[model samples]
Every structure is written in C-alpha cells, then in structure tokens.
Target: MKVYKGIGVSPGIAIGKVYVYSHKYVNARPEKISSVKAELKKFEAALKTSKRQIKKLSAKISRHLKKEDSKIIAIQMHFLEDEVFVEKVTRAINGGKSAVESVREVLQEYEEMLLKSEDEYFKDRSLDIKDVGYRIISNILGIKNELEFIDKDVILVANDLTPSDTALLDKSKVLGIVTDSGGLTSHTAILARALGIPAIIGLKDFSLNVREGDEVIIDSENATVILNPDDTTKAYYLGKKQEYEDRKKEILALKDIKAITRDGVSVTIDANIGAPEEVTKAIEYGAEGIGLFRTEFLYINRFELPSEEEQFEAYSYVVKAMKGKPVVIRTFDIGGDKDFPYLGLKKESNPYLGMRGLRFSLANIPMFITQLKAILRASAYGPVSILFPMVSDVKEVIKSKDILQQVKDELIQERRDFDKDVKIGIMIEVPSTALTVENFIGIADFFSIGTNDLTQYTLAVDRSNENVADYYIPLHPSVIKLIGMVQEVAKKNGKKLSLCGELAAFKEGIPVLLKQGIRVYSMSPASIPEVKKYIREITLEGKNIPDGFHQGEVDGGL
Candidate 1:
C-alpha cells in the first residue's frame, strides 16, 4: 500500500475505488474573421446558450440548495450579460477576431488585470472570472462543461478543482474528494465542507501517484489516503471505517439529548456554517444553534456590495431556519489576506495586520451600516447575535456598536422592525483581547474565541501557509493557556464563552478545551457527531473531564 498525506479540511472516511479526474480545455488561438457580422452573431448565440445553460444549471442546483445560496449562479449568469464584458467581446470581434478568440482575449485581459494583485483573495477572484470566461467560451465552442468520467461511488482524484468545477459536481456519485492543491481556506475546501464530503487537499503528487480503479482508503481524520491497499491494510481501514460509522450512530443517538455531562451541566453545542444550506445539516446533526454564520459567502467574488435586502434575505433564511435558536452571525471578516475587489480596497503588503474585519468595516462606514441594518432586520425573525471579528480593543467594539445604533436609529425613523436588544459579541482571538477580556465585559454580550486566527496572531504563524503549517498547532500549550485565560474572564463576568474554530472541531483538542473550563464547542456540521461522541466518552468515564462531568452509570452501549 502507498500512502499520501494531505490537509484534512473536511472530516469523514471513505473506502472506494479511485476515479481520477482530468480537465480537457481548448485554448482559443486568435483567429481573424472575414465577417464581423457573422462573428458578432456567433458571439450573441453563445451568450444566449450560456445563459440558457446557466439558468438550467441554476434550477438544478436550486433543487439541492436554497435560493440564497443559489444566488451565486444567478450572479454568474448576470456577469455573462454584463454590458462591459459583452462590449469588450463585441469590439474585439469587430476588429476581425472570431467570437471564441474575442472572448478568450477580453476575458484573459480582464482576469490578468486582477491577477496582478499580491493578495490571495483577489487572485482567487481572477480564477472565478476565468471560470465565467471559460463557461461562455466553452459554450461557444461546444465543449463539454461537466466532468466527463465520473462513475458512481468513486473517490475523485484530481490535480485541483476550480469553483466552477466544484459547482458542477455530481453529489450522489462522487463519494469522496482528493485534490493535489488547495489549502484549508481555499474555495474548494469551503465547497467540500458545505457538501459534507470526505475531502483531503494539498496532496501535491496524489493524482500523479494514483491510477483509476485503485482501491483507496480516505481516512480524512488523519489526512491520509492509502492507495492500492493489500488485504491486511484494507482490513485495517475497513475496521476504522466501521468504527467511525458506529461512533456516528452512537452520537446521533445523543443528538436529541442536550449537550451536557452526566452531571447535568449544559454546554451549547453549535455548528459553524458558511452557507444557508448547511443550516439543515447542522440541525440534523443536533446543533443547538449556529455558532458562526460566515457572512462572507454573500459578499465575495462580486463587483458590487450586497444590498441591504439581499443581506437581510440571506441572514433571515438562517435565522428563520434555526426556528428560534440563537444564531450568531459574523460580520464581514474579509481582508487579512482576503479581498473584495468591488470595494476598491487597495493592495497592501501585509494585509493580515492591515484594514480587515472591524477596521475595514469601520473605514467603509456605509457598507458597515448596510450590513448592520440588515442584520438588525433579520434579528426580528428570531434570536440573533451579531459578532465582530479581529477586534483588538474596546474602541473597535464601541465604534461598531455605535454604528449599529445609528442603523437602528435610521430603522426607527423609517418605522422598520428590528430586534432592539440583539446580543453583541466580539471574537476574543487576539492576545491583547484575551488578556483584556474584562474591559469588554459590559460592552459585549458574549465572547467566542476564534482559535484559528488566535493561534495565527498569537504565534505569528500563517496557518494557511503549507510550508509552515505544522507550526500552526491548535493544541499548542500556549494556545490552550490563552483560551484558559479567556474562559476565566468570561466565567468571572457571567458571560457565555464559546469556541468556534478548527480547535473546537478537533477530537483530541476537545478534551483539552473541556479541561480548560471551555464548554461550548462549535464546529463544522460533520464534526458534531464525533466531537460529541468523544465528549460523551470522556464524561462517561469520569476520566480527563473536569469535576462533576460524570454523574451516572457508564455504558458500553454502542
């Protein structure tokens, strides 16, 4: 058996035959056309066909997704009809270029203009634009758009997957995913997590080393893939798979039960979700509430900021879906290595420490006010909490709350409805904030430690950088100590403290967190079962858990 290690962004286990995926794209050469009218007509036809296909595809996707989540497809379709892009193609064709050639050149030029940014997010947008370009150009050229060789129940091995490619995936047949490139924050990783598929990315040589029909074991827990395993090796992984399923069964049995120890101490068990569709999965997995609703999904990869109604619609969907359970919606945490080109955010050398999170929002007051107003409107539906990210001090929190108040005032003047008493919170991620938690006690309603950024900021380690990924340890003693401090402060002030990061989802780290007096664990939807199972196990045994965790008889039930 051959083994490959990758970054496990999504958790699960899959034992299946490998189905390697390859993309066949046609590069359009600059072809001079004899008739500008003919070429323009061809371009128009391609645009029409692309729109038809996009709408058809959007309808298909909407069947599996909510309207709020399917808006990206609509946005892509609108981009196809954007007059600026179409005019560029028209001018190129009028200059004696074929329709395909015009599309290829104009889109390439547009994409290249954005690709010049050093920021990763803008670079990512360039890929998205390129995807849109390919969709239209390929429609014009009559090239097959979907992955051609997908077979049922097969683990897909690919060099890398683009957003367009990920969007077109056949969910039923594609049992698991393995990609050679992409980090934990990559678009592919986010989509994989949303799909709840077992995925391991950043395996640079995986596709090259594996062949089709190879029996593969995807142990995403350990980020290892076993290729062409012999009987003994296969048996080991098969047993692991069974154990995983059994544990899931046991955890699901407790899904209806409150997330509490046998001693009857309750802790909030929530799911951190990126999209509206994940809310159903979170609820199915017994998530009491959404700990983190990353609002960036509604804001990214576009040339315009989302409107107040659009933001309200997205938030209201999640807020309403939770059915009165408290949903914590995070403000736009972009910048800090993430970018929104539409905002005209200038390129910065060190984006991580630059205008990001509350700072960026503070600078863009109009956008900030728009989001705050939308969130407030959504809060009227059910219990909602607003969280600000990358808060270094009380001033940012005070300022944000002030703007929120202004929005509320405007809403009141306009005689609009809103939750006047919505809870306000800040991420206790920075070291200074962790130490100075008391200063923020009265001003904020709660504190949620974003361990991913906390670890990154605390240790000065770029967690997304693969070369130094090993250094970005969530289990580091220093990280645990900082969390312990935050927990102490939260407890002292009678404020609820929740952890919503990669650490909370980690099986091993759960015990560590539980021991640190941290009770709330918010993770990905798929992680709820295992993390809950581990909590149950330790608390049942009265083993490493805190005092009063085990109060009743333990069972070897499942």
Candidate 2:
C-alpha cells in the first residue's frame, strides 16, 4: 500500500515485478603484476573487446533506429580511442598494477575529474565515461553487465540511466522505467517516451526500498508508483488498467479522422517531436503539422557540434517525410538540461532564466547562421517554418529575423534554392512576452505558447523538480490569463497561434484553451488520438468552462 510519487515522462500503466538494476561498477582489487607488458597487453585486448561489443550493440540499435539515432553508441567508441585515457591506464599498469586494477583506477580518476567540474557538459560526459568504463571492466572480468541480465518482463528501476544504457533497452522485456534520479527532460525520459514505455522519474530514494520480484504498479497518468499494493487496491488498478487500454484502442481507431468538434469547429492537431525517428509516430497519429520540432536533439548526446549539412539533412528528412505538412523547426533551445561542451558557454547558477533559446542563438551568430541556413534549405522540400524558443523581447524576434535575412542572402549568393517566404515565429513562454504580445505581433509571423516554461517562469517553479511537481499546476489562473492575452492579440492581428506544450493536450485544459481562441495545438504524438477524441465530444458552440475557470479559478479541476 506504500505510494511513491514521481513525474511521468511517458504515459501508460504497468503492473509487474520490480527488477532493480544495480549501477555498481566492477571492483578490481589492487594486485601487483610482474610482467608490465603482459598487463598492458591484457588491457589492450579488453579495450578491443569493449569496442567490438559497442559496435555490436550499435548494429542492433541500427536495425530499429536510424544511423544518426544510433550514433549515441559512438560515444563509447570515441572514449575507447582516446589516447590520453589509454596512456593513463598504461602508466598505471607499468607502475606494478594489474590490468583490471589500472583500468579501474584510471577510470575513477577521470570520473572524479568530470564530476568536480562546474560545467554541466563535463558532468554529463561523466556518465558516458562510466558507461564505457563499465563495458571495459566487464570485458576484462568476463562477466555479464546489468543490461544483459534483463531476461523477463519487469519494471526496470535504477539510480539513473545513461544514453548508451537507454539505447540498448529491449522494449518488449522492459515494461516500464522508474529511476531515482531523472527529470522530465532527461535523456532517459526522452528515450522512454520515444520507445513508448511507461516511465516515472525523480522518485528520490524510491529505488533503494524496492527489492527484486516486488509487486509494482505504475500509474503514469497520475505519476504514481505503488509498491506491494493490497489485494483490493491491486484489483482496482487492474480494472483501471484494462479500462485505460480499452479506451486507448477506441480512441486510436479514430486516428485518421479529422479533429473537429461536434459543433463543426476544426482545429489543427500537431505533434512536438524531439527527433526524426518520432516523425513516423507523429504521422501515424494523424498530426496535421509539426508544431514544435525540438532541434536541440541534434546537438546533445554527441561529442561535437552537428555540422550544417547534418542539420540540413535531418531537417530535410522530416520536411520531405511530411510530404507538405507544415513543420515548425525550433532553433536550438540549448541551456538548462541540454548544454553542449563545444559551445563553450559558461555555466550559470540559474540556467532557466539565463542565456537560453533565442538568447543563446543571438550570442553565437555563426551557430545561429548555420541552423537558420539549414532550416531555410529544408524549406525547399516542403512547407517549413523557423521557430525561436524562449523569447521574452520583441527585439529578439527582430534580431532573429534580421539574421535569417542574412542567411537567405548568403543562400541567394550561393545559388541555393530555399523558400523565400518561409515564416518566422517566436515562442511566447515568458510572462513578459505574453503581457506584451501586441508588441511582438508586428514583428513575428506567428506565435506558439510553450506552456511548460510559461507555467514554470510565471509561477516561479521549476517543472522538472519532483519536490514541487504538486505545485506545478498548468491550469493555474495566471497561466490561463496569459494564454488568453496572447490568443486575443494573435487573433486580432490575424496571425496563426498555437499551443505546443503539455497543456495543449490536457483533457480538462483543452476547453479552456478553445475558449481563449487558440485554434492550433501541439503535444506528444501518443496524446493526439485521445485529445482528438476528447475534442470530438466537446460542442463548444457558445459554451464556457465552469464560472470559476472563467473568473480566475486556482487549483480545482477545470
């Protein structure tokens, strides 16, 4: 009957036994070796074996994932090729330590160095170092790693999951993912969503109390996990699970149908995707367009910045695949949880309010130019729009448009074909921006409300923190008021407005947004069918939500 609350990144229900995955690295005892050459040879052989294992794992990933998507596994390959890392291990071995002991010691030093750094890039890279280090040690010790031991259906619990660890997950066997350390925007969360698995994260110390084979119930909709539920509770949740599945099937069957209300008001239903692989699911879910294509995925989880050609290829793939459905490609919204080392950006104490979104793009013109050129070039394939994220000022929009014009001029000089009429938009996630929506209507072509950040900044809460997840209400009166203001301005100006945040697909909030005159909605692909079904039932022809909602309600359900 013990209940633990967490944030659900993916939506679903799972009733299964717990499989606590250990994050312990192999412990190699300090041992003196007489032959330094033999020890070095053994270490080299282990490194080679580790590389082969990574290659094999990458191949397995490639079968189901695109080559670019599979590149996450290459992080390990780069580590294996690091001459300095190899030299450190060799020096330790030459100092009378065994191959296993030397490898373990050197890896610990490297991990400590990264962990001590203030920069988040180095801190995140420590995970990659740990992933590759574990593989190498496992090869030397001739033992199976934790991932290789997932042999049955279970709720996989861990302290955290690395990018490589998540990429190798066998979705059929891993029923759901529960982690002690992770946020809504973590790599594990992103991978779980992409794999369509039920996930609950930031359950601080939840993994410590669970044992293998413990009965677990994960209700992702409410972000709840029950450990060893009572008979009555189990039965209740079992029935709920069945009802959810039945309802899901019923809604999913109407995927291809238009998202029109019973009163005949039609609204665009788009999807917000993080990667190219998700485009398939978006199309399958009957998305009218791509409301938010998070381009930051191209930069993160890699060692270096993505070249313009790479960016262009990725944007082009999605544009061409949509076959003319409008795609709004958001420029790199890097900062906060997604900082890259190559960018050389300073680490700030408060990243959410720091240089992020359009601010980051403006600071680095070359990088900004590269991305704009890619998005513009991709527009030639189909209808494309460039979206600037986290915009708080009208000047940011004007400056972004100015840079866009510069890129278009460069393209013209280079004789490259692109859509000259490609639309430029800004995300009104900041409260100040929403308050001054009229000022931006003249500069930006369109607007999309990123309710996630808007709620976070407006309410002075970090939505990613599970401690305050209770207080991070999306339907708060202030947030809704901001939405209404933006919608009113956009409507008066005859500019297209969309909501591309989690609130867009919220069942209760949909009616409120409709009342605000927001006609376009974008959310995760899995939510589209259910949201569309909910929309179909609503006959909002001169209807209003409850009086409290219209008159500044606080916490009660809409």
Candidate 3:
C-alpha cells in the first residue's frame, strides 16, 4: 500500500480507488499553414470538436449521475456554446495562430478578465470556464484523460477541484481528498463536506510536492495528513479508524429515531436547505421539516431575477417533495455582501450595515411581494411558513406583514387560492430585536435567531473579516445574555423560539442553549444525528439553569 499526504478538509472516512484528473491539449502550429484561411478552417474544426465533446460529456454526466449532480455540467454546456468565447478563438486563429495557441490565447484573455473581477463568486466561476476549456482541448487531442484508480483505499489530490469535478468523483471508491487551494466556503469544500468525505484544502504546493501512489494517513478533524507513515503512525491511525467506524455505525442506527430527549422533551430537528433537490437529502437525513429555505440561489449564476412562474415551479417542487413537512421559506436577503449582477447593485462601502435584509425588501416591495405571493400559493399544497430576514424592530416587521397582507388580499380578489393563515416570523439577528423583544413577541408568529449575524452585530465585528473574527463569538457573555433575554421574552408571550444558526449546530453550544430553555435547534441536515445524540445524552446532572433569567410561562407549540 502506498500513501500520499495532502490537506484533510471535512471529517469522514472512505476507502476508494485513486482517480486522477488529467487534461491533454493538442499542439498544432499554424505557422506552417500557407494561408490564413487554412488556420481559420482548423479553428472552426477545433470549435466543432469542442462542442461535440462537451455534449458527449454532458450526456454521460446525465446518464451516470443523479439530477442534482448533473446541474453543473448543464451550466458548462452553456459556456461551451457561448458566442463570445467562440468568436474570440476564431479571431485568434484568423490572426495565423495555431489551434492550441488560439484556444490558449482566448482562454488566457477570458481568465485575465475574470481574475480582474472584484466579486469572489464571479472569480471562482471563471475557474470553472478554464477547467472546461482545458477538458475540451484535452478531448480534442484524443488523450485518455480520466481519474486513475490504482488502490482500493485512495486519497484523491488536486491543485484545485471544480464543482463538476467533485460531482463526477466516484464517492463509493474515493476515500478522502486533499487540495492545494480552496477555502471553507468554496464550492469544492462545500461539496466534499456534503458528500461526507474527509477533505483538506489550502495547502500550498501540495500538487507539486506530493507524489502519486504514496502511502498517506489523513486526520480530518484536525486537518492533518501524514505521508509515507511509519509503523507507529500507521498503528495509531488504525485505532482511530476503528473508533470512527464504530461511532458512524452508532449514528446510523439513530437515523430513523425521533429527536426526543430522554425525558420525552421533543425538539424539532429541521434542515436548512438551499436547493430543491436538497429537500430529498433532508428527508433522508431524518429531518422533520425544512426550517430555512434560502431563496437567493434562484438569482445566482443567471442573467436576471427568476420570474414568478419560475419561482413558483422551484418552490412548489420543494414543498411537494417535503410531503407533509413544514417548509419555511426565507425572503430574498440579497444586497450588501451578497450581490445580484442583474440587480445592478453597486459595491457598498459598508455592506453589513448597508441596504440588506428588511431594508432591501422594503425598498423593493414589488419584488418582495412577488415572492411572498408565490410562497403563499405553494403553502396551499403543504405546510409552509414565511420567514423575513433581519428584523431590527417591530415597525419593520409590521411593514413586511402589511405587504404580505396586501399580497394575500390581491390574490383573494383575483379568486386565487392562497394560504392567508401562513405563519409569518422574523429572524432575530440585530441587537435591537433582542433588546426590545416584547414589542415583537406578539406581532411575529415565532423567532428564529440567526446567531451568525447576531454575534457579528452584537460584537461589532464582521464575522467574515478574519482580522477581528475572533471577537465575533456566539458564546460571549453579552451574546449569551441577549439570547437568554430573548428566550425569556418568547416564553413570557407564549411564542416559539428556535435557532437556525451555526451556533445551534455546535455540540458545545447546543447543550448550553438547551439549558437556557431553547427547545428547537435548526441546523444543516448532515448535523442532525450528532445533535440528536447530544440531546439524548443530557442527564439531570448535566442540566443547569441559565444565569440572569427565569423560564417564565411556557405556552404555545410548533
């Protein structure tokens, strides 16, 4: 057995064959061509060949993978047919460049354009285009470019992997992944995490330094990888692997079990989903409902905002897929850090405090109402709830509610069936909402604490800003005190309070939150089993009364 070490990103163990991705480009010099027309003819042929190859790959992807897995390939198919890209290559070839030279020149130009972009999403998207281009060129040259599987237990390494590459990976055979580039929020890292594969990224020069088929051991929890391990290290990893497998089996057994405490206190374990296909995964992971269905994805990677019919189709699918499960759809919270190219939102000087959340919704009332109407219509098919983001005060909540009422009234006047009684709630993130909790208690149906933003706002530190990220602690005394206060207010008014934040998913934070009288903990579906396990382990000895607050009157239920 040979091992090669690289970064370990996500935490999970797998044993799969090594499938290395390599691309081969054709080298053809047009300098020997007697006429520019000949060079142009060659370029046209290359373009045709590239298009055919992309179509073939796309067909293969659709045939072999799930519908969700083939989405990225479908997007790439559009790029392959882009007129500008084709025109650029043709122009370069007309200039008497070789086929390889023309393709490379056009790709370089596009890459440079994308590299100059200020938006990270667009910059990353450019990388996808480059990868597609390289793959097309490689296919044109008749290169047998595919991942190589040499071992039963293999660790896949790459300089950087695209979403398509990650999707194409044979998860059944691939054990772990290590890459030289990508951040925690990068698509490659997110995909690896979703697939439950141990992954490590952002290691400098890993591809250049690591050799193929070298023996490796990956410690995913700590993001460590050991190359060509010694006997002692090998033995240590074997023990660790056994522990992991045992724990995994234990978790798997609890998959169908309800998330009820030992004392019979039932907590709703809902999943936070982004895409329609994720609804199935949520159900498979034993999620009782969809707590937070982000709608921003509909606006991303597109040329315009999704039409009402389009939005209805997507929302309807998710609601129908959930069967009878409650699906809480959050209104579009775009602007600030999240931009829509079609919306023409300029870069903000201070995005976190700029036009975002409720502010953006209020400013674009028509857009907000359109989504509200669609969501309400979908609610008729299943249990659906509307969640508004960034509610700092009761006035904003009132305004949003007023708009929702208007949409419902209009729908009723038109004799359209709509869920007029759909539950309306606010995301209690800003400190103002926590400070003046009573004003919002009766007005809103429930409160979903977005701790990621609450902590950032309370600490006056940007969570995305690494410089002061340490100060943005969800468990800080101030933050804990505020959460305690909010929970107390919710209890006093007989309202439901749940947390749909990163903090709720943390093992340490869950115990503390539960002790503070938090009943519902919403998190990523993948985290359901572990959170449920922790809840089951809570004994009387482990329970502690929260400081600086009383439980007040417990009333109302989800």
**Each candidate's clash count:** 0, 0, 19
Worst 10 residues of 2 by lDDT: 549-558
Better of 1 and 2 by TM-score: 2
Instruction: List the RMSD of every prediction in angstroms.
Output: 5.2, 4.2, 5.5
Instruction: Please give the CA lDDT of all the candidate structures.
Output: 0.78, 0.81, 0.71
Q: Could you tell me how far off, in angstroms, the CA of residue 462 lies in candidate 1 after the best superposition?
A: 1.0
What candidate 1 gets wrong by more than 4 Å, as runs, is 16-18, 25-38, 66-69, 118-122, 145-153, 162-172, 183-197, 209-215, 540-558
lDDT of 2: 0.81
Q: Write the per-residue lDDT of candidate 3 for residues 1-558, one digit (tens) a residue.
A: 344443344775443333344343324332455676766666666667766765766675555434544555655667668898778877776777765676777777877876665555566667667766666555444444455333355778777786656766666667888777775545576667666678877675666666767666677655676666778878878887887778767775676677666667777788887767778767877888888888876776576677887788788899999998888999988865566666877677787788888889899988898888888888888988889888877788888888888998988988887677899888998998889988886688988988888888898987656567567777898888899999999998888888887787765576678768888877776677766766666643466422311111110000
Looking at candidate 3, the ten consecutive residues that score lowest on lDDT are: 549-558
Best by TM-score: 2
Span of 10 residues, lowest total lDDT, candidate 1: 549-558
Better of 2 and 3 by TM-score: 2
lDDT by residue (tens digit), candidate 2, 307-344: 99999999999999999999999999988656676677
Tens digits of lDDT, candidate 1, 411-492:
9999989899999999887899988888998899999999988888889998667688778888888889999988988898
Estimate the TM-score of every prediction: 0.86, 0.90, 0.87
Q: Which of the two, 1 or 3, has more TM-score? A: 3
Ranking by TM-score: 2, 3, 1
